[model samples]
Target: MAARPDKLVIAISSRALFNLGESHRVFEEQGLQAFSRYQIERENDVLEKGDAFPLVEKLLKINELLGGEPRVEVILLSRNSADTGLRVFNSIEYYGLDITRAAFCNGESPYRYIGPFGCNLFLSADGVDVRRALDQGVAAATLVAGDSRKRRDDVLRFAFDGDAVIFSDEAERIYKREGLVAFTKAERASAQKPLGGGPFKGFLEALQKLQAEFELDSCPIRTALVTARSAPAHERVIRTLRAWDIRVDESVFLGGLPKGEFLRAFGADVFFDDQPAQCASAAEHVATGHVPHGIANVDA
Candidate 1:
């Protein structure tokens, strides 16, 4: 294992940090050699910002607010070899991102490096890599190139789905096996039992650590739990959060309504959900990441 830093470390792919769609297309259609030549030919050209650029920008801004103490660190994990990755570094310098550490995996999935880097969260354009990270019990999200509109840069807001994201898919499995009526009954009966922690649990805890650095009223970070749960189902989620001792600034129980408009209203920087439908909706409003885990992803 690599040295784990005490800071809140975030691991992001090069494609997530910058727009690499053109070059990625080259790799997909042509192959690695063509992609390598293409990148080398344009090594000096600065890449445009990707969907996650705004979110990454705001996350790094936290360090600036802390007087350069760098309580948060973002790492670059890419499939590009060092030789072909010069353009990425060049663009990073051009954007003036504070990121300094990276792992050039040379066309390999970079998920293996997550533990060594002590990543509280990992985001990637590649769904395969994201799934691999989640399999290792790391909080990972597949970044969706949604609206890409930049929001207020001062406060970084995050939203998450309850089951299969913040909590285990146990309840989700029950819901799948049994009908909604039975699932609701089961939840109501076991309301006192704390649901198992999901992948993003550690990441949320890390955010709490960072939040501790500032006053609650002034903290620039906000989190929300937006779920399809309503009425009796909401109690279990509330009790589960209480049991875990985690703090979410806002908890919206959508109870099967579309979440995009609500997420837009919340001014979320990024929203995480296991359901593609929910993610697609949220992406229309803000940056969204698909957590391909649990029952929703059993066949996925």
Candidate 2:
């Protein structure tokens, strides 16, 4: 029999690890306020005294809740010099991280940022840069993890947006570059048509293949569509997903209202959208990924 593939591999910066507020309670009990300071400095600094233990514990818990299914590798990226890197490494070792993989990227490495190392989930504290990475095809998120119950295998909830995410942003782009009047007229004229595919298309196809590997009824991966498009415009969204043979278990048409509340209620492990406003709000309440669109030139 072929050997089973290695569990999912995650590469996280130290900042990403501590930014998780849900796990903050543990750190608070230990009398550490690492998050606030890190946010204020806007620099990747080493943990204060006794700060490393709680952060490492949170990482271990995240791994455990995922059934230890994903082997997590953390890379500490800081603006400090070699001495600071050595201190951070020493603290990590003192805290007992089974970290077989790590590296020290000079502060400049942030500018050379491509994407996370083969991780489906990339996170960043800087919104603009994160979005830029996403637009370039990196599935990136704000560096925040929530404290929620480990999701059951029974109801796997997946959610998506309409424009620029699940569907081509061409219309939105035209709308942005032109005017609302022209955009509405164009959308109405093409009401019976579908736009070109979006980034998630290939990933959705991979999901379909994975679904076929397991029986649908027993399949744990459930999907949903949560978008601002309402009514007449909604038809194309539904049809597009159907045409792709992808199944969404739950869907909501918010029509310009914020998606944070609905996304929180949905209890998603990871949510992806292209809008920074929506992603910022959702990231506060959930593991949110900002799908970057049209910001590639900035990174380039």
Q: For all the candidates, what are their Cα RMSDs to the real structure?
A: 1.3, 8.1
Candidate 2 at residue 6, lDDT? 37
lDDT of 1 at 11: 94
Worst 10 residues of 2 by lDDT: 1-10
**186-241 per-residue lDDT for model 1 (tens digits):** 99999989999998988888888788888888898999999999989999899988
TM-score of 1: 0.97
* Model 2 C-alpha lDDT per residue in residues 1-300, reported as the tens digit of each score: 111123223344555544334324433554334433433343344444321223334444434444534443444444334543454565566557655555455443341334434433345555555555456564444443443333544344556766776677887776667866677677777766767777665445544544454565765556667887766556767776777767777889887788878887887656778776677677676666567664222242
Q: Global lDDT of each model?
A: 0.90, 0.55
10 residues in a row with least lDDT, candidate 1: 1-10
Hey, what RMSD does candidate 2 come out at? Answer: 8.1
Which residue pairs overlap in candidate 2's backbone? 135-292, 223-249
Question: Once model 2 is optimally superposed onto the true structure by TM-score, how far is the C-alpha of residue 202 displaced, in angstroms?
Answer: 3.7
Give the number of the best model, judged by lDDT. 1
